[model samples]
Target: MKVLHVITGLGVGGAEQQLRLLLRHLPARCEVVTLTHPGPVADGLRADGVPVVHLGMTGNRDLSALPRLTRLVRAGRYDLVHTHLYRACLYGRLAARLAGVRAVVATEHSLGETQTEGRPLTAGVRALYLAGERLGSTTVAVSPTVAARLRRWGVPASRIEVVPNGIDLARFRFDPVRRHRTRRRLGLPDDAFVVGGIGRLVPGKRFDVLVRALARLPGDCRLLLVGGGPDEHVLRREARRAGVADRVLLTGERPGLPDGSPGPDLPSLACAMDVLASPSPEEAFGLAAVEGLASGLPVLYAACPALEDLPPHTAPAARRVPCGDEEFGRALAEVRAAGPGPRTAPEAARHYCITRSAARLMDVYATALARQSLSPAPQGVSSA
Candidate 1:
């Protein structure tokens, strides 16, 4: 079947990672198309022999691209168009309908109302999002929290499905030797403790809070902030202001793709941390937290509903910290003093493997097709 996957961007974020994993494992007969910030992920898809169309979309309201996207979908005769993130969900699904696609599916990657600093949507925008998604043949959420949130916001229950995100076990598998080498290469002292975090350097990620909390810890403790985004400079300044600049390492952007290498080796990165810190006040599904757990490290995640129901291995392996600096510091110290359990990478991989998650997604896709065949299209729905 021809399946087109749409996303807001190919940036280093949870939704991108989820789409990457799905594309990698999708059946060979399936075809994929991407429309968003077609950067690294697009390159990676081509590397895997998957065809990707960028569309040069500058923002969500790129009406000019609509005709192009509609034409492409119609020409491809795609059986399904599965969209990830808000922008693609809005634009891609609409375009898919215009092209006479039988199925349009969307995965809600974040809570609809939650705003990450400077990016909160007004009530009007949120309403528009809800209205657009109503056109989707199926709506998916990466976690139950996200699914429930959409329902609460008035998304039709009949169209919503909850599907958790998945990771690649082989890529994220633990490697003791690689971890040792990576630590040595970074010049980390054998005796020093590393508290690591991986996420977009955004205001909502609260990396500044992690930096401040590190100041409260013993001097022997250091911080590693991985990934990149617009807020990198803002976060760097905050670290300097908090007097922990030297202790914080921003690894910038790394080379790896949904089809490229799995962003520097997980073992090497995981070895640099005694504990993984997540200070974000909101998370739809904590991929970083799960990755930390897969690496056999304890995670200190913010006390938020999105993170509270981490998969089996993760729930036991992570501790939750309140958003305040003092609470974060206390949570960090407590997790640090107590070591991680005997969970190995292989053990943790079972809960979030991309292969496992893909199978579940396939079931969702097939179910949508079956339901569509049996039911009439909602009244007043127009392909135009």
Candidate 2:
């Protein structure tokens, strides 16, 4: 079936990247509509041969976006409308209905305990979310933790589907040659213990905690804060304040796509690291930690519902720690003393392979379309 995906923007983030990855794996004929800022991911999607449209939404109050998106949806004649992020969900659902498509689905990719898409859970936000939710047929949560959050927000359990964020395992598979090469290219010392903190440089992500934790670690320990955002300057300032500025590396917004798009890509960076640390106390799914696992790096996370939902035996090296510099600093010291273990992805990493996530999402798609059809479930992406 034909599908159209609507998202707030095509910026480089978990949800944007995940949507691009899913389009690569999902079976349906698909096109994308980004409400604003058709940045790198949109460029990447176009390069990958997906048609994308920029709606040029001015702001949240741009009511004109609704009619424009509706027109695009109608023109596409898509069988289903899949929306991602908050703003897109609000507009995409309304546009899909205006365009006469009933099979609408929105994936909740970043709903923390008290935040949705980095915004505080105000009464107005919750109410608007619920009202827009009614326009969609299904809400896919990236983790059970997020699913629970949605239920608590008054969405019916039956309306929620759990489709975990997935990774491209082959892309993240540890490569000794790449690791050595990447380390040299990035000026990392051979004996230096590299600690990776991968995520947007955001306040809620609490990357500052890692910056401070670096101050307490040995001089040989280096902090590589991957990804970028508004909090980048703040993180750099914190590094300076902590007196570890010389040892901190900030590679701004590398897609790290296994597709060989650019240098210092995520997989190569992953190979160069000895361990991964995520200090963010709020996460719907700790995707970076999983990627770290795929790279065979031990991970220390403040909160990871993705790992918490899984059996502990699946990923023994991944540990949950308190969201404080002192606590995380001790964990890093302990890991460094132990030295690096095997550089091989565990079962937990395999469980979230991109293909598996695609298959599961197809099931959700088929079910949603079936309800609209009032007939046998529609065929979706192949499990193979």
Candidate 3:
């Protein structure tokens, strides 16, 4: 079937990268439209031979985007319209309905107790979300944690589908040669205790805790932050203030999957690291932590429903720590003292392979199409 995916933007964020990965594995013919910021991920998607169109949405309240998107949807004659992220869900749902595509599915990629995709949750957000939700056939949550959050926001449980974000396990597998090459390219010493913190460098991510934790560790302990954001300078200043600036390396946003970007991809960086630490107090699925697990790196996370939802025995190398500097610092030290054990991916990684997620998503798509066939179109929504 022909499918169209609409998203808020195509930046190197978790949701954007997740969409890119999903498009590669989904069986149907798929195209994408990004409202704004067609960045690295967009280029990667194109390289992977997917058609990507930028909708040029100015801001949050751009009403003009709705009609434009509607026209595009109608012209495509898509069998299904899948929307990702918050802004896309709101606009894509309405546009799909206006364009007469009843088989619409929206994925809740980021939903926390206090935020939705890093934006503060307000009364208006809830109202608009619910309003848009009604226009779609189904809402797919990345994890049970996000599904619970959606239910708490008054969305019916029957409408929420749990399809966790997935990873290409082969790409993230540990390789000693790759580890050495990546470390040399990034100027990391062979024996350095590399502590990785992968994600947007935002306040909510609490990466500053890692900087402080670095200060408490030996000089050889390095903090390599994988992604970029507005908080880069803030984290730099924190590193300087904490006297770990020399030890912290921020490789601005890298590709989530290996799409032949210039420098070492995230998988290589993962192999170079000794441990992965996520200090973020709230997370939707904890994708970074799972990627670390795939790379066979010991993971320390403040919040990871992906791991927590699984049986504890599945991920023996992963541990949870509070999002405080001292607490994370102690965890880091404890990991370092133990030395790097065998770098082997745990059973948890296999549970989140991209193929499994793609199969499950196809099921969601088929079910959505079936439901749309049985239900009557909204009053004025003609099958144009």
| Candidate number of the best TM-score | 3
Point out where model 2 deviates above 4 Å.
255-264, 374-384
**Candidate 1 least-lDDT 10 residues:** 257-266
- Residue-level lDDT tens digits of model 3 in 195-220: 99999888899999999999999988
lDDT, each prediction: 0.74, 0.90, 0.91
How well does model 3 score by local distance difference test? 0.91
For residues 165-195, write the lDDT of model 1, one tens digit per residue: 7776666556767767877878777677889
Candidate with top lDDT is 3
Residue clash pairs of candidate 3: none
Model 1 pairs in collision: 167-354
* Candidate 2 vs 3: which has more lDDT: 3
Q: Mind giving the per-residue lDDT tens digits that candidate 2 earns over 1-384?
A: 999999999988889988888888999899999999998888888878899999999999999999899889988889999999999999998888778788999999888878988899899998999989888899999999999889988999999999998898988999999999999988999899999988888899999998899999989999988898999999899999999999999999865356634223788899999999999998999999999999999999999998999999999999999999999999999999998899999999999999999999999999999897653222431111
**Order of quality (lDDT):** 3, 2, 1
Question: How well does each candidate superpose onto the true structure, as a TM-score?
Answer: 0.92, 0.95, 0.97
Q: RMSD, each candidate, Å?
A: 2.5, 4.6, 1.7
